[model samples]
Target chain A: MTYCVAMKLDSGMVFASDSRTNAGIDNISKFGKMRVFTRVGQRVIVTLSAGNLSITQSALNLLEQRARTNPDALGIWNAISLYDIAGLLGEAMREVKNRDGEFLRQNNIDASASFIVGGQIAGETQRLFQVYSEGNFIEASLETPYFQIGEIKYGKPIIDRILTPATDLTEATQCTLVSFDSTMRSNVSVGLPIDLLVYRNDSLSVDIQQRIEDGDPYFSQLATRWSEGLRGVFVNLPKPDWLTPKI
Target chain B: MTYCVAMKLDSGMVFASDSRTNAGIDNISKFGKMRVFTRVGQRVIVTLSAGNLSITQSALNLLEQRARTNPDALGIWNAISLYDIAGLLGEAMREVKNRDGEFLRQNNIDASASFIVGGQIAGETQRLFQVYSEGNFIEASLETPYFQIGEIKYGKPIIDRILTPATDLTEATQCTLVSFDSTMRSNVSVGLPIDLLVYRNDSLSVDIQQRIEDGDPYFSQLATRWSEGLRGVFVNLPKPDWLTPKI
Candidate 1:
């Protein structure tokens, strides 16, 4: 299982993904699930993936190979819109499904994948999409300014509560980390070494692509302070009056 | 969908369930999912259900009818151990499955139900069981002192962060409410008018059963304060140093 969340806020877009991938309780490994593609002044596209590691790898490999084969081809760098980039990703996964879906189905493995592709396209605004394995996608709107793929629920409440279209880039970054912290705390399958990137609107370069590992002071303090602060807030909240003994 | 959570703490046990039930977005209704059965001095059994409404209702009806028809029968009150009571509830569900499972399956409806049955029996300490659709159940242990059924993940992180075997009843009650608040905040399928029951250790009766209706002052205040407190804590958490524009 994996947890990846991306926010298309007013100031920019934020992306975060945990590195822990597991086949079972004992079979766990660290694999970066976030992919960054930047064309300096043209675009900065980030993609986060979840589901069937083999399929994810295959799809990503195909996308990279496509870019390497023809720099001016149908890859993300040449896509006309951010939505087009998402469709390209979906098409890559669909190609993988065409190749491996049947073999996996024969073995009872579901050939499924989920992705969050978000960023800007030169003159266009920041956009985000949650692409399904079926090669279809939907763009984020003001009403829903975020997209999350994979083990999303444990971290959803905080994002639902704290983030909005009007959130700033830095604040949304912090909120994204807190959301990942909540997820990692609850699920052992989503461990440390996080890929966090913040795309400031119109900044067609990926400068804040921080691959945060465990014990990073800033992240450690942020996680510890968030937990302690939540405890303090929880303890200070009103206790159950109905349970108090009546005199 | 539904949200039900039960905590087995050193001070006692706490159970809570939201009232919203929906087959789909269009078919929404409110129904109390928590049922409390008590023999004042002998036992206090609270059961919370999350699954096919017909199956759960049928199972509860069976348990009720069995107890009323034969006081000495294998009913909740007559059960020897808390485990037996859980088994009895499981048996009731199994009976429902046997009666309706095939018909429902024929119609493509999965005849499944999940339950959290927890309370104290005569000469027994407080116990909690998460009864699955198959009627088999697992007892909550010190390491895993809580069980959540239906839409569990959104509200899971809070309880996982706060509750422990050493937590007190009132604190656990507060924690459960906060958990429900998070669930309701994120998922519209889980709505208001919560059923909250606090079972004190060794007290074989139901005294603190609060059917908290929407706009109930205490609940309203708690929810508001909690939301505000969380926002405050979130804002105060240390921001990411990597994202701050140098100096």
Candidate 2:
């Protein structure tokens, strides 16, 4: 289980992913789920993955192999647009499926992996896309400016309430972290050592790619403050007076 | 799809269930998922259900039918303990499965249903139980005071934050409604016309059982106030300073 969220705000994009993975309650491990591909000032592509770790890692390795052996081929570094990056990623997924799908199916493990690919490529606009197990993808639009993969529901209410196309990057980033915090608090499968990246549109480079651990000052402060704020609001709401006499 | 939540607090118990049922999106209809059985001043039993409406309705009908026929069998009204009522409901579920399981399975539909049953029976303490499709049930303990069924995730965060054994009946009731409101906002399958039941410990008969529709004054007020309150909290939280620099 993992939780990754990416927002395509008017100002830029925000990507966050949790690092914990578990086969069951007893077998848990920490692994980085966010992969960054960048050519400094030319392009930056962030991919957050969830599902079978082996499959996803294999797919990533295959993509990197392509980039190394054939830089001029359609790999992440050379992809002209975010859509092309998504396609190349999808192609990598299919390649993995062709190689491992039958063996995994025989062992009753579905050849599964999904990703959120978002960032800027040289000439195109910043965009976010959610890639599916089938290697198909859908880009975020103005109406739905964010995409969430993995344990999404526990953290979705806050995002649904506060995010919009016009939301500033600062607020969106805060909201994403808060969303991650809420999810982590409720679900043990999603844990610390979060990978957070913020990209300012047209920069064509990684902006703020920080690793947030258990005691990161800003994240800790924001989480504690938000929880307290929620409690305060909860208490301030008028109690259902009608319930007094009835129950 | 349906959403129902129930909590057993030291003060009493709270049960809330949405009234939407759908065979498909186009075939959606309204039916109360909550059923109340009360022998005034003696006992009150509330059952909130989710899943195949036909199966749950059949199970409830069987329980009621047995009460009418045998009277001394494990009928809710005759049960001496809340656990007995849960057992009776679970037995009823098995009966439904025995009767309809083959036909449903042949059609490739799951003979699935789950219930949150809570109340006070004469001579026994107040209790809550979550009954499963297999006619098995588990009682809520102090550590986990609440149970939710059907489309549960969207509304889970509020309960995780607010519910505790010491939470007062009024606060628990409000929290349950807010949880339902969050779920209803995000899911089309779970809608208005909610059935909310509140039970006070020791006082067997229901304290309040209200039918809350889309325009019910108190609920409408709470919904509006909650949304505004959440937005207010979002704005009040200090934005991460990092993104501001990028912008």
Candidate 3:
């Protein structure tokens, strides 16, 4: 299981993904799922991947190979728009599917994956897209403002209640981490060593990236404070006043 | 779509359920899912049903008819333990399956249902059980003191974070409402008019039953306060320090 969330606020974009993969309970291990593509001052594309690790890794490898061999080809760095880069990523996914989808189907494993791709090209505004396994995609708008992939339900209510297009970049990052903490606490398959990246709109450069593991003091403080705050609220709600008398 | 939760704590028991049913998106309706059976000084058994409303309703009707015809013949009122009542409910479920399971399966509707049954007998302590469609059930022991059925994942994180056997009955009820509110906010299929039943340990009667509807002042107040409290916490959490020095 994986949990990755990305938000496109008016100020910037925020991306966070957990680093846990498991074929089964006994075979769990760490694998970071955030990939950064940049051609400094030209374009910066950040993607969060979830689902069958082999499929995602192969698709990513295909994308990297294309970037290296074919500079004039439609690649993330050279794409005219974020939409075009999303299309290129979808093309890579289909290529990987052609290579390995049949073998996975033969073994009864579904050839499935989901990706959240968000960043900016040199001439375009910052944008975000959720790419599906079928090589189709949808872009986020002001109304939706965010995209989440994998193990989403346990953490959805908070995001639905707290985030909006008007939210600031730093506040959006805080909300994303709180959402991740809720998911990580409820699920064993989503473990620590989280990757978070913040992209300031129109910067076309990458710098604000942090890798958080257990014992990270800042995350530790936020998690503890949130828990204690909830407990306090739970203790303060009014009890039932409708307990009628029974004969 | 439904959200029903039951908790067995040292102080007593708490049950909360939403009251919305829909065959499809266009045919949604309201129906009570919580049923109460009380023999006043002898036994009190409350059952909350979810999934395949027809199957559960038929099962409950069968149990009611059996009690009418022969009050002493394995009725909930005279069952020896809460466990016996859970078995009785399971038996009723199997009987319903035997009668209509084939027709429903042919029509492409599953003959599946889930029930949360709990209360106390005269000599027994408070107990809780979750009965399955196959007429088998599991009890909530000290290790895991709660059970939820239907549309569970959206509401699960809060309960997982806050509930324990040592939690007081009133606090347990508050937590259950919070859980239900979260589910309701995330899903339009699960709606209002919540049914809440509170049983103090060793009180072999029903008194603390509240049918909370939309516009109930106390519930409305609690819900508003909880939402505000969460937003407050989200705003207060410290922003990432590592975001500094971005180019």
Candidates arranged by TM-score, highest first: 2, 1, 3
Candidate 1: lDDT of B44?
89
| TM-score (C-alpha) between model 2 and the true structure | 0.97
TM-score of 3: 0.94
TM-scores of the candidates, chain A only: 0.95, 0.95, 0.96
Kindly list the per-residue Cα lDDT of model 3 for residues A1-247, writing each as its tens digit.
Answer: 9999999988889999999999989999999999998888988899999998998898888888887899888876577999987887788888888999999999898779989999988878999999998889999998999999999988899899989998887788888888998999889899799999988888888758889998899999989988988887777777666642331
Tell me each candidate's TM-score.
0.96, 0.97, 0.94
> Compared with the true structure, what per-residue lDDT tens digits does model 3 show for residues B13-66?
888899999998999999999999888888888999999998899888888888
Off by over 4 Å in 2: none
Say which docking band candidate 1 falls in. Answer: medium
Residue-level lDDT of model 2, residues B1-247, one tens digit each, is 8999999989889899999999879999999999999998778989999998888999999889889998876677777788888888888888888989999999998779999999998888899999988889999999999999999998998899988999998889889989988898888899999999988888988888888988888888888888898888778887666656666
| All candidates: DockQ | 0.67, 0.71, 0.56
What candidate 3 gets wrong by more than 4 Å, as runs, is A243-247, B70-73, B98-111, B244-247
| Alpha-carbon shift of residue A54 in model 1 (angstroms) | 1.3
Better of 2 and 3 by DockQ: 2
Model 2: native contacts recovered, as a fraction: 0.65
The residue-by-residue lDDT of candidate 1 on A42-63, one tens digit each, is: 9888889999999998998888
CA lDDT, candidate 2, residue B182: 89
